[model samples]
Target: MKSLWLSQAGLDTLDNTVALCPNCHRKMHSLNLEEDIIKLRDKVKNYNYK
Candidate 1:
């Protein structure tokens, strides 16, 4: 698994960690935007079923 969020000071807590697939991990890192990553998080958190 790869991390969605990383920090220079280091994130040593589970709250700041997200497990991402290899491709998505690469894409997220490539995009390198916290807001975009956060949007993804929101989508996952707010997913709905119909």
Candidate 2:
């Protein structure tokens, strides 16, 4: 699995509750908004590294 990070669209929806990597945030803007949400959900569910 790949390391998961927050996207720009995700950050927008988060309403300033989270920090984002600049490059990831920029790339996220190029992706479909809906797809970003879906990817975020999947990333959360699979977030078990801790």
Candidate 3:
């Protein structure tokens, strides 16, 4: 959700958010994965738009 704009499209609802362990969450954020977020955001937006 925070990684991408999933929150803006209601895609960040509980049904969609994943449960991550603390370590994993930290690792993911530490990577600064903007490209991944952008790609995922676009993919989900496309899927939802259809």
The number of the candidate with the highest TM-score is 1
Model 2 pairs whose backbones collide? none
Flag regions of model 1 displaced more than 4 Å.
1-4, 33-35, 44-50
TM, every model: 0.53, 0.37, 0.38
lDDT of 1 by residue, 1-50 (tens): 33434554556787666677898888877877778777887876686737
TM-score: the better of candidates 1 and 3:
1
Model 2 Cα lDDT, one tens digit per residue, 1-50: 43333442333344233344886666665664777757766776686756
Candidate No. with top lDDT: 1
Q: Rank the candidates by TM-score, best first.
A: 1, 3, 2
* Model 2: per-residue Cα lDDT at residue 8: 27
Better of 1 and 3 by lDDT: 1
In model 3, where is the ten-residue run with the lowest total lDDT?
Answer: 1-10
Ranking by lDDT: 1, 3, 2
lDDT of 3 by residue, 1-50 (tens): 34433434646565466455887556556774878556655666676523
Show where candidate 2 strays beyond 4 Å: 1-19, 26-32
RMSD of 3: 6.5
What's the lDDT of the predicted structure labeled candidate 2? 0.55
